[model samples]
Target chain A: MHREDFPMLKKDIIYFDNGATTLKPQCVIDSVVEYMTNHTSNIHRGDYDAAVITNKLYDNVRNIVSSFVNCDSREVIYTSGATQSLNMVVFGYMKKHLKKGDEVLLNKAEHASNILPWIILSKQIGIVIKYVPLDNNYELTLENIKRCVTFKTKVISLAQITNVIGDVRDVYNIGKFCHENNILFNVDGAQSVPHMRVDFKNCYMDFLSFSGHKMCGPTGVGILVGRYELLEDMDPLCYGGGMNSYFEENGDYELKSIPTRFEAGTTPIAQVIGLGEAIKYLMKIGMDNIHEHEMKLKQYLLDKVKDIPNIIVYNTSSNSGIFAFNIDGVFAQDTSIYLNSYNIYVRAGNHCAKELKDEINIKNTVRVSMYFYNNYNDVDRLVDALRNSKDIFKIVL
Target chain B: MDNDLRREIIMDNYNDPMNKGLIDDNSYLKTRTSSESCIDDLSFMMKIENNIIEDIRFDGEACAISTSATSIMIRILIGKTVDEAKKILNNYKNMIEEKDYDKNLLGELAVYDSISKQPNRKNCALLPNRAINNMLEELNKKNN
Candidate 1:
């Protein structure tokens, strides 16, 4: 692949922070810039030619995203980001569906974005929130889920791939269980959608949310894919001009259809169009190829760091892009600083999954997340830098 | 990589931290705090007898600046009166905040004077001092 496709990568920088947000491809950027500069218009509103073009482009991107996740366009709803999508599901659904004494089952390995919304909702409504403990390897097992679920269980929210440990769960099996028990299954796909292939139809999930920036697109755009019937039943999160069809003088208003009902006024049209271009780019490269490339880099890094004594590697089962580890005696932040001196960038905190660190009994671990753009040479450079700074970056036993 | 930002003593102490364990007895007051964003936790213990700090110990996991700052703090705080310790804590805070700190009084803390240059790590270096001040406040509240 041509590295020039991504203008951000041209700057002598080895960005290993893809898990935070990915570098936008030139195709995606051009798509966004074209829309912003030339064809800019309020979508689904004005009757002008520009507005018509804008509406088609916006809806086409929605169709593209729906196809990317193997769902219908009606199933895809745009939000500010994955966090907003998650909050929309938790708050929007719980307010309408969950009754007092209902239970929400969650995994201990969930990101704060996935967990905190449910936690807050549980506090607001009288729903009981319970956690399914991970096994020795930080994997959420069916057995654990069975132990955690009860008759009062109304929903099960989990991360498809843990941001910190890269532990991928069996969302299909979990979805099966939830469906069998009449529970709503919500999957946080922020970390998984970028590096892995996700088929909503095959997964049998009721709801799934993913951010665009994590998948080589621009920020401020995310998708929440939910079952058509379920989304129709759930109330809209935000009330606004775009979402309402007609309003009577006596406070009576008809809401727009699904997807638009959820999307409030002024959607991120340009970014969503750019996200479509991003999805097209990924489709050309193939998600499986991206997965294979990332796995190769992950294995290369693991192999290089394995022989180094006093180095702690987290999540060896990571088939995806995330690699979480710590130098034996060195603090994660210090190790990150030392690596930064070499122009290699890796996230060194809990990666916004605060509960996972405590659940895994780690204070902090350095995380090096891979992307399709990263190659073996990048891994080699990282290994060389780590090897050279063993004394400064190693933790004392 | 700025010369003024890098602390040689802080790095040395981080590599080889001193007084890095919990005090066994309950004679000392203990305060624990952690940075949720960075996931670094720190615990401070001051063994005070007759209103004088006899010994100090720290136990936690943190960055180089934090570990080294704690080590340097415990080393300097031993055998000082409570009032004197508060004065030293204030001086250390001022130094990290780039305020006009008395050069002669802040002896070993001068090693960390460059900490002002690295703004992000400034909180890590001041964790121990914050814990001490918080502990003193709690002690005063209890006495009242």
Candidate 2:
């Protein structure tokens, strides 16, 4: 819909790898460039013109994030990306609170970022990592989660929308369930936050993690929003100059409060500024519009390929814009290569969900993940390339 | 190299691979290699007697580049001594890395000359070659 907002549209490419990272809008890019070119100074320390500008931009991002996610600004913490955010949740918070044998419910559809931290935590503490089985459509239903829930299930951690399957998990209902059951709810919003409106307060989430790059912001920035009380208990995974309030030679140091304490040292000021711009850009166009456009695109692509005998789609019933498919005998990478020949970029292979192989029964699939910027022409090009995939080998070599 | 010729080389080697299965023999040293990113998990088995690679076989799910490259690699390394195979694999590595490699030495492996352009696929083309190369290096170490 807002295709013109993205500068990459000027290029001769059809980018369908938004599941990995979205194309940055001109406004987002300009924000970063402007920050670097003009106000190239460290945030929060200086009272000078540049520092004031940078600090205002950086600090105000918390409000932007809070407004976007419907969280308190005090609850927002900045990290490298979703991976780091999830790590802080597991190591910083869960490791301290979760006792041995406490079960954390997860699914195979989650990206490694969400799963690996808990797996590592399981190794550290005697936490039991349990996989809530996916349904026949490979969707994680609340019913399956309910069945897996035991008294020992201390946490229910999941992606709001899976990367490969693109199933929009009912985080609202699941969050309510967790709230009622007195379980900690951690939502990996890496796939969800970019596409839809996620009400962190209303969802009753204890923690939420998401990246900036996947939402048209620059890399090296992400938001980690924890509940206010939980933020007080959570220790910083990283510690240095900015986060500390006082230090003495007697091996004693006092750290800052809630969110700032978690954000140790110099944060990605430019990236944070870029992220704020990205969020503002997104809100202007509206989240509901983005989601609706993606669903429409998904259905359009599905209906077009349903008749093609050799084309096998994995997630026809999935709720998002992701399309996982392959030509009958072609390898996922091979299909991706063929599509690249037509200047259409898509992700291929395990897609960082290595455990998904056991559930889907196939090791790899070419994934075409759409964003709001993608239009009908992009899909038509992909379809045309798929139709002419007999020459895949010819081009791939 | 013509694009059609390259396609034929890859497709031919992929469709009908050489010694495409591992034997349950005690003498054959085998190793399974796969990327956590891609789906290719090939078990490469080798039998070496007095420094010569008597047999080499591989079996797994892989893309055309990986399968075809592995097949062609097996054909090239079989019956060659450990040292010779090392030299050939070094040349193949050189070629894959876009370093100065002997043009005539590669023969059929020359089809992947353009693989460096698609750097992402370089791992796929080099997977089995690297495994077999490591085996040869180990054999060289033990024998020397």
Candidate 3:
């Protein structure tokens, strides 16, 4: 665990809310601060020293992202976050290509960012939205997806790893299936890319969306990597000076190509530069090593919590480090409050996966999502706190 | 903070809440409310006869504070007139906001007197009050 890299770890608290966002590493913060302090200038416009430095640092992130996610640099589109990226995919591309009555396959475990835009699209056009059911383990396997697919299934969009269940979907197999069937594949990498190696080319993904903040970078910057051909077909959700080549008074204009066209406005320049540094940081640490560490930590937490009888643990078999649980008779918020009293931070609620109740039969849960920075001490602290949750009301009251 | 009194009242009311179920009566007015941030979803029903709060009931899943507070609230409002209930609500809101209020009027409701300190739980403490206040507004509109 690279705990020392994150200044937040020095605080007397155990943060297990990585599903929401991870704590930023010092290098990422320093990079952003350095840009704001020393070399602050608008990108791709000026030839001054500050502007040159800014443009180089900002533009170079495309290569960094391409290498990080294994996609062409020309295909990388800077966005506000995964939410905006997803919106661009659904409204910008899918709206035009997918006609009325065409079906899109989704699952209940998907976060709202992945589901809501499609729902809006279904309402606007007449596209049919179908949900593939999760198996007994609350997982979406390729078999389940296959059962839900029809000839009209034009698209299959899913999170590579679900935020709540933390179960990894076989997107590679699903992508291959889509490729053969000529169906479009959109991967919500918000919960996947940061923790593991995601090869966009190998997976045959047409679209991939991920936020920088989730991977220990700054907020307000995200990456959307689309297949080059599809990116050429996609439209920018925004329009401004940065993305245009030339314009005429009669509204006749030429926009830039592929990725540049999609990133229309003045982008979050500092955050993007910081995100590049964060990607390099994660690369140095090794995605496989980060993933392996998380799995081990998840297993350790599962084993340690076994002795606590009244604790109702959910998704014990999830491949990722997200652990959802509740003290049998206690409310999730009460547990969260009780834990907060002890400096243990966990997320408590629907977690924006509102439709997940159909699968889990519960509306709310206390989620403890981890990053590689987490260690055994954090789990021990959590178990110790949970073991005394009987005295929860004592602290909460 | 009245820790002892608050703890005792909360435990008793939460374990076995008063008026914790809805009636099948057609005359009563009901409304359901849920918190967007937390899991405090509760439904409230009130029967007002001749400007008096004849009876009230609530049913659903909520945190201990929400359940216990609603339990205490329904118990207090059962036999009170509509005007009296409004006064109680006003005073309760005042207390929740950490403003000057008559605490004797709150009785068991004062258990959440210090809830303002736990700013995050203020909504949890007031979720029931919000729903009941809606019922009050509807009743007031009908009466006018």
- TM-score of chain B only, all predictions? 0.88, 0.94, 0.94
Report, for every candidate in turn, its global Cα lDDT versus the true structure: 0.83, 0.91, 0.91
True-structure lDDT of candidate 1: 0.83
Instruction: For candidate 1, write residues A98-197 as lDDT tens digits.
Output: 9889998887678898888887877787788888888888878888999988778888888898888887788888888888888888999999988878
Superposed Cα deviation of residue A67, candidate 2 (Å): 0.9
Native-vs-model 3 lDDT?
A: 0.91
DockQ values, each candidate = 0.42, 0.73, 0.77
Q: Proportion of native contacts in model 1? A: 0.67
**For model 2, which pairs clash?**
none
For A1-397, candidate 3 gives per-residue lDDT tens digits of 8888889889999999999999999999999999999999988888899999999999899999999999999989899999999999999999989999999999999999999999999999999999999999899999999999899999999999999889988989999999999999999999999999999999999999999999998999998898988877877778887889999999999998777887777889999999999999999999999999999999999999999889888798889988998899888888898999889999888888989999999888999999999999999999999888877888888
Candidate 2 structure quality by residue, lDDT tens digits, B1-144: 887778888899999999997788978887888866566778888999887889998887899999999999889888888778888898999999999999787889999888999888899989988789767666667668
Q: Write the per-residue lDDT of candidate 2 for residues A1-397, one digit (tens) a residue.
A: 8778888888999999999999999999999999999989997799899999888888899999999999999999999999999999999999999999999999998899989988889999989999999999999999999999999999999999999999999989999999999999999999999999899999999999999999999999999999999988988888887898999999898998888888778888999999999999999989999999999999999998876679989999999999999898888888887888888999888888989988989888999999998989899888888888776677777
What is the TM-score of chain A, computed separately for every candidate?
Answer: 0.96, 0.99, 0.99
* Chain A TM-score (model 2): 0.99
> Candidate 3's residue-wise lDDT over B81-126, tens digit each?
8789988998999999888899889888988888888898888888
> What is the overall TM-score of model 3 with all chains considered together?
0.95
**Clashes in model 3: which pairs?**
none
Which CAPRI level is candidate 1? acceptable
How should the candidates be ordered by DockQ, best one leading? Answer: 3, 2, 1
lDDT of 2 at A161: 94
